[model samples]
Target: MANFKKGVALVLAAATAFTFAPVANLAPVTASAAATQIADATDLNLVLGETKSIKIKDISAYSIQNYTVSSSNKNVAYVTTTTTTGAAVSADGATTGASLTFNYSQVGKTFDIYAAGNGTAVITLTANNTNGAVVTETFNVSVNDKIEHISVKKTSDNSELSTAKPLTIASTDIKATPAASIKTNVTATVANRAGTTLKAVSDDPTIVTVANGTGNTFDITPVKIGSTTVTVTDTDAQDKILASYTFAVTVARADETLKVTYDSNRDGKNEDYKADSTNGHSKQGNAVYLDDDKTSFQIVAESALGRKITYTSSNPNAVSVDNNGLVVVSDKVKQETTVQHISADISVKTEATKIGTTTVPAAEVVVPVHFVNKKYTTLSVADAEGNVIAQTVNSPVDLADTNKDSKIDASDDAVITLSTKDKTSVNLVVASNAGDNFVSGEVFAPATNGKIGTTKSDVVTYANGVLTVAKTDITTDTRAFLVLEAKPSTATYGANAKITLQILVTTKNANNVIDVAKTLDLNASTKTATIAAKATYGNILKYELVEADATQADGYKAVAGNSNTDLSVNASTGLVTYKSKNSGSQVVRITGTSNATAVAPKAAYVTVNYSVKKNASDLAVAAKSIILEEGKTAAIGATASTAITYVSSDESVATVAADGTVTAVKAGSAEITVKAASDDKFDEGVVTIPVVVSKKAENTVVPKPAKVTGVKVANVKGAKVKVSFKKVSKAAGY
Candidate 1:
């Protein structure tokens, strides 16, 4: 039945005995066989407002309507009856006093008794003959002032939490939470709680806090690392303790702890976390001997376990973290950037750790922190259009094709046509280190007789990072090795901060031609193509056809399907066209000679391959969306006649191997693109399917078993007792 529960139950002994759920075998009581006798019913103890049930074993012997149930104390308790024969339900529902009679009940059935008040109640079950009451059964019930019981359940899954004394809310049951604290929602069930509501408060709000919830539930949130007691009582009873609902709480900082580190380079590596030893002391990054004036940089917070990481600074006064973890230095810290650097501990959190059904307390570690001296953080320059090009202090950036005509050249007469004839010059912006004042600026270029950085150029000049080359300047090389010197003119910029920038300048109209096609893979439907060639002077060159052949001079042959008539070209215009005559591919060899003089590599050969394929019908990816748990695998499928390869848009979320086996790497959304490689029978095709990864689900709930229906008692002294229970739907067994 109920495995002998601690509460009340009915027992069968010759159709009359005391009953308790946990096998409390009280002595049997029977009525005289000649008179209308009472059947079994006992255990008359209850809480202030609780209900108990009992069954009638000898119900077959009498009609249910012949019995009238009543309580001697109308204000103490009441009785209600029901039948197993599916007869009209109890009319006792309408009568709330001490007694109730069934309007239509079958012979064999059960009835319920509810406690109405905290006092002694005498229940009388009288069986009537036609002449009036003939047999009477009296039960004395004791009603206690306490609630029947109390319980707590989870808000997420409705699963009951630990009901043991001093209940413990384990960390393994927590969900993902922020860095502040852990929050849990609890549901409590109690007896004698009809007109009252529960209110919960923490003894120390700095450690923990509780909010009143509807339906006797409470939300418990832990604030920090400390201990406190939560008292759940009626709102009016603020000082009065609730013996049944009070609990002790120990708080950690957050629900999900994590192992994290600082990555100064943002490369998902620990390049910054390593300590360097250098310059008479220790620790080295970039060499100042090479003019490494990089002073300010950004750092990224990373989780070592691939989970998302958060950031917090231990000493926010020196350097604080913004909402996205970018560093914001205070004025005091910025003033000391030259010799002092702020090295502070950063606290970081990761997503919750759950492997399959088991939850793990997040791992913690003191990650190695990177230390560096304060210097000028970065040096940036702007173009003629004021577009800033940011670079690290000592790195070099080439000025290729700056005029935007797709050529790089410098002529002997001056520079090239791009000499700054107008007032057009490339403007630059210098980021002075924090706490430093700027005065005046001048740029110097390399000269033949001067030192490397002390030289000056005859063609171009620079001041305050602005470099310009004029049409009247008589110089051939556009290369500008600029040294911005500290001059005495209290104008706009710099406090003797010597910064070096290597800018490779390119001018137009030089000696060589560029951009001759090595190979072409064009499948344009009309098959028209152009052999493009351009000179360093920023001009497209006209060409003459040198060779067009069907046979290979070298061992390389045309693709399997070609013939002599497949190619045609205009010798004057250098325009080519190909006519595909078969299902497979064909390759044609052609050589072009440019009219431009004095250029190297004159014999330029172009290889053009063409193919045609029929479209495959009914091509589609099998799944529109697939869901998988982390580390789980699934196969990719699509309808196609050609070979297929699967590609995941985000490999960190999911990975697809060459054989189309897709594996989930973490919990996120990704797309898998299925590509069908073309063959003679099918054209290339692609289909993308969305995939979602999730944590694995765990089973937790178990249903209660069947119920006790009847008990068969033997008349023989030594006979054993046989008990039967009602079969629960879908139950494997009792």
Candidate 2:
């Protein structure tokens, strides 16, 4: 194997030697090779803006240096660089602060600038000790703008110290120029102190005012020079006062002083006076003086000294104040307020007159009164004090215990006419303080001077305006008052009315009788009673009666249930017993009477205890039993209550009638039964009666033949009688 391997190696070495011998022969090149020998001829001398490729013949690797590109002069003057191997000018050329920078590597290279848009520039690149050589290049680039934009908003309420809210003033522009000056009203022109004319755009001065204080001076023409209180008011479009100033006018005065007296304590007096010399005070708010040249003084009103400010005036007048420098008005025609400011005097005057007027029409009122039972009731007329000054009384009356105190006496009159004038109409509602003693009615013409005006004849009629009174609801526990109201037309409403009426709610105790009471059991016999009695409220006496009695009592009497059984009652106490029969339930009708006749009939029912005895007769024998043959029949009968029933002991022997009768038909024992009546008394008891039957009988005898008859006899037809008899007849008995 070793010998074979050596031979093969020898053959491989010879083949390799042959393969390289031709390439070494073809290039014959050495270290003295030309540039064109290292790279392609056309690829040599590369342009400044182009890339080039280097190639070698036969040799696989080599190096190049000192490659260059010349510009402007051909003294081999080229873009400078360190001579090295395998370097070249990039497509963008070398970098400069003014242009782009070079970035080169063994295989790749590039150029860049901090920004884009570099102009064309000549540059060079030298290769290192590598096969590739140096090159030259030139390039240009365009740039794009890339600035960042940002925004921010204010944090506060979106306001700055330098900015101001727009201002508006009534009757003028905020420039303080008159509106009429904007048009044809030249005489009313507003001029500035600096010899400038204020321009305005408005036309009507009465409709608007303008502010011109931007320069602190303004002028108004066509006005009298003497001092006059000019009420200048400054307000925003919404009538809100942001700031206001008041000043005096002079021929040359630029600054004006506004004087004010303030009640610091609001005690109805001016405690201080302030002067504003730089600007006028705002009437809409606190007034102040701000002129640097003038001294601001304080003044106090006389009332500030804690002394009562008194004003003397005519009768029927009054005065007051709000304690805030507001003077209380009085009946005085003129009023004055005084104060001291800066060792000087100040006063304000105001005129006063009646606010309105009032008048009272002439009128009268008529009051109506009602009473009942002649039982002393009172009516009264009173002032606002509730005191009865005028009063009258109806005769004796009992108002009943309205308070339930068990007493009914009171002191007053039931009717009265009060005399008064010029009053307001009021309704003194007739309220029953004791029992139902009062009722409501209309009181007409209260404001008329005792002259009852038109009367309402229906509900309340007054012919020719004359007052007439009528009574309503008089019986039972009742009382009333006639409210008279006179409303004055002059007085203010709610204060114009006057109430004066008589409280005729007089009550007195009187005698009365309630009906009597009774009771009964239903088992007792039915019966009735007559009740008759009469009662009166006062002195009147009455009588009554009802008749025909089983029993009589002081207050009632028992009677038959007949036509006259109804009760007739006395005037005092009615006969409070029966007017009806005691039908288990009895009704005792009590007829009440007053003034000798029956008034009202009242009834009460009681029960009566009653019972009934049910007696029934025993079933009676109507007829005796009849004899019959065996084939015939006979019957026994009895009579009893319609409801009685009959039964037979043996139907084969005899049958009984429905009325307790029995019949015999066969020869046997029998019985008759009669039950108690079948009315509701079936539950009482049943009765039964027995019946008998006899049978009739007849006798017969027979004899028989023996041994002689022993002979067989098949047929024997009435031939002969065979007798096995010991016929021993004792002498002539046959």
Candidate 3:
């Protein structure tokens, strides 16, 4: 019994030792190691230039005070200075990028992170402890370099379509209007993150097609009138679709400013319309001309979109026109040496009324034709051009605007008006079929009625027809009749043709002013500008370059006949180029003569104040405002001579790349700024482009629970109780 008792006691002691052996070191109860976590980051996948927000929940022993966010590569994954809790602030400082906003210090402080570029980044949310140890939570950001937007530009102008707007090509009736001016090729641009080269494919080749060009540009040729999408993909990414752009080839129509061109050379084409020929297009201001024998010639629109041309005559008794543009002249032209005219009304009819006379073409599609008689006269008094100011008669005292165009032009006869009743002498150049002998002989001075208004006197004496318009015996509104006897020896007249002149002298008239509009800039791309000057009452001012000597080259003298190399003036076109640089301000004088020689007898001047200083040209941008939805992108239309850098004011809202591509992040506003680096030829320029970011139209809906089977109430204490339920798929909140 004693030994049994001892064994029992020993077992009991061993059991006791095992049961309460201080249970201390087996393992401490660790509650699964609670962690400091980011509640929103399951996986950090971001598009380049995109921004996202994260929350760092203060769990376990991690405190919220003195906590800061940082990125490993600020260029790739960047942190912003803005914050909701105002935890920390920085620029492109040691710990943060110069972008984004984050709210810190709260239990779950929000952290705004930006995928500024393409690459991987390690972002850490660190909390400082009293001890040297620290609590840190990290997120690895993966950014995909890809395309975001695609657009087109006119190769001639470099202007781009609006953001999200399709590249539209107006209709071209090419088959019907072969001479139509339409450009089919356009340059395409892809706004990308890492500038990965992309290939473009049109959904329908019959609508449009894309051909890859240099760099990130492509050539898109419109084929027809329809809408097609150009799918852009990264071939290096195994043909992954990056973005898509739309091309809407809209229907073509005739130009608003319709013009009817005369095919004067008896051909069905406008190849004979000389521009200074082969200079380019037809003389945009070509005067009307008709070959008397040039019947059956065509008259059509310089540019038409399947429209018809209709012809009618103002005076069918003088000249008649057919709908097919056939002109017939009648024998009503009695003046052999003088020029005469008959108005012809031409218009474009909407119906493709077969180029023949079946329908009447009227308003809606018509442009009032400004025409003059295309003539080769036997006798005329004109300027350097054959624009006859006065022609020898069989004229019925032609002093009025015969065409009733309100202004004095070539269609009007010459009437000398004196600014004052002073004895002013002038010269006249008579161009006639009469040889030099008849031009100098006693062919002029004789009057048919043998009087100046029933009185005989030398009110105006004629010496050589080239000079001597003597104003010794002149009065107000004086009329003189001078008859010329065309001698057979010198005159090209038929048998006994006589040319008569009805010279009228008038008094001073008010409102004789020349309105001058000139542009003078030395450092402009187009140093030359055609002076837009107008005379009183719409008389076209004739331009001439005045001559200057070598000494007065820069004397601001006229740039004609002179040896001035610093300037050039096109006599034909009043286009003046100011090429002088490093020179101080000088006045360039150009001859501004008026066509109303009777009113403006003396010469006039158009002065351009040429003050040119050589300086660097400033950079420029075409767009004023940029607006887009979240995740949408656009490009800044900035032009510069050197490399450009871009920055966004609020990277959380929008971000711009080095190439001026802008990406919208969240719903907010930002300023995208472009900076052009300074070089020898260009000044450093900075322009701020405003951007408005709108929330995307996408709606995210959480799913409803299928059944509330496990839902129950728990932890009932006082007035509060806890409710528990099974987590449902995609159920966001309780």
RMSD of each: 42.6, 49.6, 45.5
Q: Give RMSD (Å) of candidate 2 vs. truth.
A: 49.6
Question: How many Å off is the CA of 290 in candidate 1?
Answer: 24
lDDT against true structure, model 3:
0.46
Write the residue-wise lDDT of candidate 1 on 1-734 in tens digits: 11111221122121111121211222222333224334455545554445555555443333323445566665666665543344433323443322223322322346667666667966655554323324556677776432111122222211132223222232223433332334677655554434444566777997666887777677876544456666655422344322235556655322222323343432223333322112211122321111113333344443322333455667777656664656555567555536453455544444343322334333332232222333333334444456544323322112111222112112211121123333335566655433224423444454443323455555556665566663344333254444432221222222233444443333322234446676544443436677665444334344432333323333244333223455555544556666655422333343333233322222345665554434443457767788999999987667676777788999999999987788999999999988888765456887888999998777777766655565455554566555554556866445
Q: Is candidate 1 or candidate 3 better by TM-score?
A: 3
Q: Rate the local accuracy (lDDT) of all candidates.
A: 0.46, 0.28, 0.46
lDDT accuracy of residue 271 in candidate 3: 31
Give the Å error, residue 20, model 1. Answer: 31
Candidate 3 lDDT by residue in tens digits, 1-734: 10110110111111000011111122222322223343445446554455565655534343222345566777777665444356554433344233332222234545466667657977655443323334445567776432212234222211133234222232222222332223344444444345344566777887556787776555555454445555554333445434444444332322212345553322232432222113322233223334232222345543232222345656566556666655555555433345444444433333221111222122222222222232222345543344444453322122121232123232334443323334233345565554545443222322344332334334455555532335444444444444443332422322322344455444433235666644355443346677666555454455655543433412234544532556666665667776765343333343333343335533345555454433464678887899999999888878877787888999999988877889999998999888888764455788888999998896877666466558889878898989887876765444
TM-score winner between 2 and 3, please give it: 3
Error of 2 at 354 (Å): 69
Clashes of 1: 12
Stretches of candidate 1 off by over 4 Å are 1-312, 316-379, 387-451, 455-459, 463-480, 485-499, 502-533, 536-734
Count: clashes, candidate 2: 122
Residue 207, candidate 2: Cα error in Å is 80
